[model samples]
Target: MIKSVWQGKKTFKAQSKFGHDIISDAPTESGGDDNGASPVELMLSGLAGCTGIDVTNIMKERLNDTTKFEITVDDEREDNTSRSVKYVNLIFDIEGEVDLKKLKRAIKLSVDKYCTVAHSLKATIEPKLIYNGNEEEL
Candidate 1:
């Protein structure tokens, strides 16, 4: 298990000997120094990074020679709430001559089953994915 402790000011610092230090703070609107990424942004980014790694690894394992992998996540929030993410859309741009079928299947497996972050977030949010430069749904 992992544990963290925070002290004074808007800044809270976390450290693990095997991991990089983490710093969190309130947004400028909330009287913080705005020194780090907002919590919501970090959450979305975590999901994107996890799925991106899974997709890239799958492609590489298939000997697809994937050259580039980019994932962009956009979140929509409902009004008058605590700014929780209501919807998340992920766009994956993969560069290589990879089999579209395999790419899609890998992404589906990651988002629907393997990605713990995506799975946890899905309970309180709607998640969608776009794959391989296709405008069609995935």
Candidate 2:
């Protein structure tokens, strides 16, 4: 579980069950200090982090990595007052010596089987999430 408490104007301190904590604040223009990401950004970050952990663990356990790795996520969503729906467009920048085929499979498996973030989002909106170079559904 997680909890959030009002920290001040447009800001809150959020903590998860394991004691990890972070500040969620609005943009500076919204009277916030801009010290941390907004709540929406945190959701996206959680999606990326969940997928990243899955891929890393899979690669390591399979002895597939021969160098360092990095991942990045890009999204596409528009502001619409008519509905409470949003979608994601994730683009991953995977750099390392891992096999492309295996890596793609790893991503597929992660999105197909292991990613709770994707599952959670899918509960509300249909998210277009891709891994490696393959587009996947949740």
Candidate 3:
């Protein structure tokens, strides 16, 4: 199981079962030292990383010569009252010689099947695929 310990005010040191530790801190204005990424930021990063990992493996197997890859996670948060995330969008920027259809399929597989973080999040996430420079709907 994963564990998170309060390191100090508005700061938490999260430990993974795999032996990795990451720090989460609120902004200085919120009482933290602003030393590390906030928990929400880490959550987004984790979601991106999960999908990225799946896509990378699929690329290798398909022999896709992808030169650049980036995932952007966008969402809105309700901070004042309920303090919850509403909607989320995942934009994939992929470059190089890759089959657009296969890339889209790979992404679908990631979000729909492989990426646990994607399914674990509370908000519904829409995956947008961009191949080369054109946006494609799958």
Candidate 4:
């Protein structure tokens, strides 16, 4: 299991065999040092990263050449509750001459079928996808 020690003043050092120590914070507005992304932001970021990875990998497997995969997530909250992310909108701008059908299918599989993080977060959050380019709606 991973271990972390609180170093005081909104700084905690965590270590795992996976990689480097992670420094987390509560955000400056909430009395943190703003050292890293707040937890909620991290969650959204995880979703984006997870889906992006899956999409890229799938596209590569399909022999689709992509110039870049740009994924952005916007989080929305309700009723002023700070702990829960109510909605998340994901926008993907996939550049290149790849077939729109393949791109859409890859993204769909990532969000709806393959991505573990997306599946885990499906209940608590809503994810919307917007594709920039000629990708036809699926």
**TM per model?**
0.76, 0.77, 0.80, 0.77
Error of 1 at 82 (Å): 1.0
TM-score of model 2 (CA atoms): 0.77
**Best-performing candidate as measured by TM-score:** 3
User: 44 in model 3: Cα distance from truth in Å?
Assistant: 0.7
Q: Candidate 1, residues 53-124: lDDT per residue as tens digits?
A: 787677666635767778999999978658778899999887877888998998998898788899888566
For every candidate in turn, the CA RMSD to the true structure comes to 12.9, 11.1, 13.7, 13.4
Per lDDT, the best of the predicted structures is: 3
Residue clash pairs of candidate 3: none
Better of 1 and 2 by lDDT: 1
lDDT assessment of candidate 3? 0.86
* lDDT, candidate 4, at 90: 92
List, residue by residue over 1-138, the lDDT tens digit for candidate 2: 787889888889989899999899989897998878987788888888998888878877654554555555666666775433366766667655668898888888888899998788768555576689899877
Candidate 4 lDDT by residue in tens digits, 23-90: 67777788888887776776788799999889878888554566776899997787675546678899
Q: Which ten residues in a row have the lowest lDDT in candidate 4?
A: 126-135
Pick out the ten consecutive residues of candidate 3 with the lowest summed lDDT.
59-68
Looking at model 2, residue 18 earns an lDDT score of 96
Local distance difference test, per candidate?
0.78, 0.78, 0.86, 0.79
